[model samples]
Target: MILKYSNFEKSAFLTEKKFFLFYGPNFGKIESCITILKSKLNSLDRTLKFLNLFQDDFLRHSFTEIVNQNDQDDIFGNKTSLIFSLSDLRVSSEIIKLITSQDLNIQNIIFKTGPIQKGLKIRKFFEDSPDCLIVPCYEDSLLEKKEVIMRVFENENIEISLDHKNLLASLLSSERLNLLNELNKLIIYIKTTKKNISNALSILIDNNSHDLNNLVYLLASKKRNDFWNEFLKLQQTFSDEIKFINIFSKHLEKILFVKDKILLGLTPLNAMKSLRPPIFFKEEETFLSQIDLWNFQNLRKAIKELHLCQMSILNNEKSSKSRFLTLITKILDL
Candidate 1:
């Protein structure tokens, strides 16, 4: 039977079916489903021993060997979960032959593949079979991605604001493993530094060098000479100007947030200190200098213009660093 990715659950796998097919372009989620299925199966029957096979090695003889095999492999009567990954229709005839020949004794075989169009007989065969279930693993939705970010942060006791959480959800890799890898780096960085994920986040998202974060943090400083000196060193590292604008704009928003908060009964330092996923300890001096440099109103205006500049750069493909130069001149002059 066909199973939708959205509808898949532990209960769905709790069945008499012995064969399964998980196919999709989203390989990360395909692995995730496989992990879930194995965990559920293991809960019912412990110490599952997995046998890994490829499409090339799979044959009728291989199937026969699996069928004839006893539980001598492990003392726990290990359930065999044959994982045929990166599969295609070439192995379908063998599977069909085995199904037609007799009942499948090995109940944990799974086939994982890339996208299978409707014309593929293998997908159809699994769909039609009572003992087989085919599920499509697809990319995650925006809301789903956001939920992952929230869950990860909540688990770490690292609080993130709604705005940042949304931005991260938007910016992060859609693939489950890649997304988790990025989040893992962020977790480590946050724990070690006891600081914000902004720098690490910017680096990961843009594929930029870690030190470029220093340049971004420096942009908001009142010390123009220091910024210009460091700007030259890091200018070549600005591989993606759009990403730079994104990080820089976000930095400004951080200051703008503090500036806005200052309108209340809080001091600039207090407002900066209050930021969750706290500002980097080393960057605190520059962050405070930013608060003293620009008023809330101008900083807000500058941030908006920076975003507009980003759009202009995106639209005007011919534009160079000159545009950033012009924008920075205007901002520093402010």
Candidate 2:
């Protein structure tokens, strides 16, 4: 029942499953796929109808009652899609089971969520069910972003010089949604405004990013104002709290790697320079500055805090962002 997000057309849409749940941190990819799903629904059968029922409206009727009501809506028994809006509050197995167990007449029952935890009952049901298709949409990694940049850059007919392509890709947002949006704006801005396109685009791309990478350096360097400013932008930019903290932990691990290097008698500057992908040129000074601030004790303590913060999120703690920001403060004091 689990389908790769990229294979939705061949593997998922053509299947006879009645339930489709697209859940993850990749909001843009989820929405883009949904648009394709809806279009396929329309073209696959013109007689088919689409109905949207909100969470409040759904509570008034049982799952069976909802299906039966739609069944009776058209005397000809034309197929219809019943997409129910659900939040974190009502994602119970009992309710999900009510729909999956039935031999329903609905064409599709689509559900969308921000990000479902691994062991959540709702995610478990969808993954286990043959009648359901679950597609997880997470942020693209750097490798994937490189491929995306080429594809999007080519498709958008971007006319930037070859030397700037690598720079543009590196500066791009990791989110597929924001990446495309910013690319479009970049193209338009290029057409109308020629001066400082690269500089303007770099600022736009970095600002658009839900950038844990930048925040880590800021916190480790004890730049309080910049750290919180980026934190505020991150909250508004992306809904996936776990991904945010996960990125934070990863950057800490990077610095920890450098600490290990320093222990081997390599100078801090040389240790940082030895990093494989290399720190951003703009961030090299910041990285060098933080090397002096971090030692084994604080590095271990900060990592321990990150582990606890991740646990808080998995436990469904209220304001996981608070836990994340607290970890930043703890690291600052270290």
lDDT of 1 by residue, 134-228 (tens): 88786565677888899999999888889888778766656666677777878998899877877666665565445557667767774578778
Give the backbone clash total of model 1.
Answer: 0
Instruction: Give the deviation of candidate 2 from the true structure as CA RMSD.
Output: 7.7
Evaluated against the true structure, the overall lDDT of model 2 is 0.72
As for candidate 1, its clashing pairs are: none
lDDT of 2 by residue, 1-334 (tens): 7898768766634446678888887777787767778877777787878887766775687656776777544877678787765666364654586675656556677887778878888888889987788898876655666677678668866655655766666556657888787677777776677645577666665654536567666877888888888777765445445655666677777788988998999988899889988888888887888777878788778778788888887776656656776776767777
Residue-level error in angstroms, candidate 1, position 317: 28
RMSD of each: 13.2, 7.7
Q: Which candidate number would show the highest TM-score if scored against the true structure?
A: 2
Q: Residue 52 error for model 2, in Å?
A: 3.0
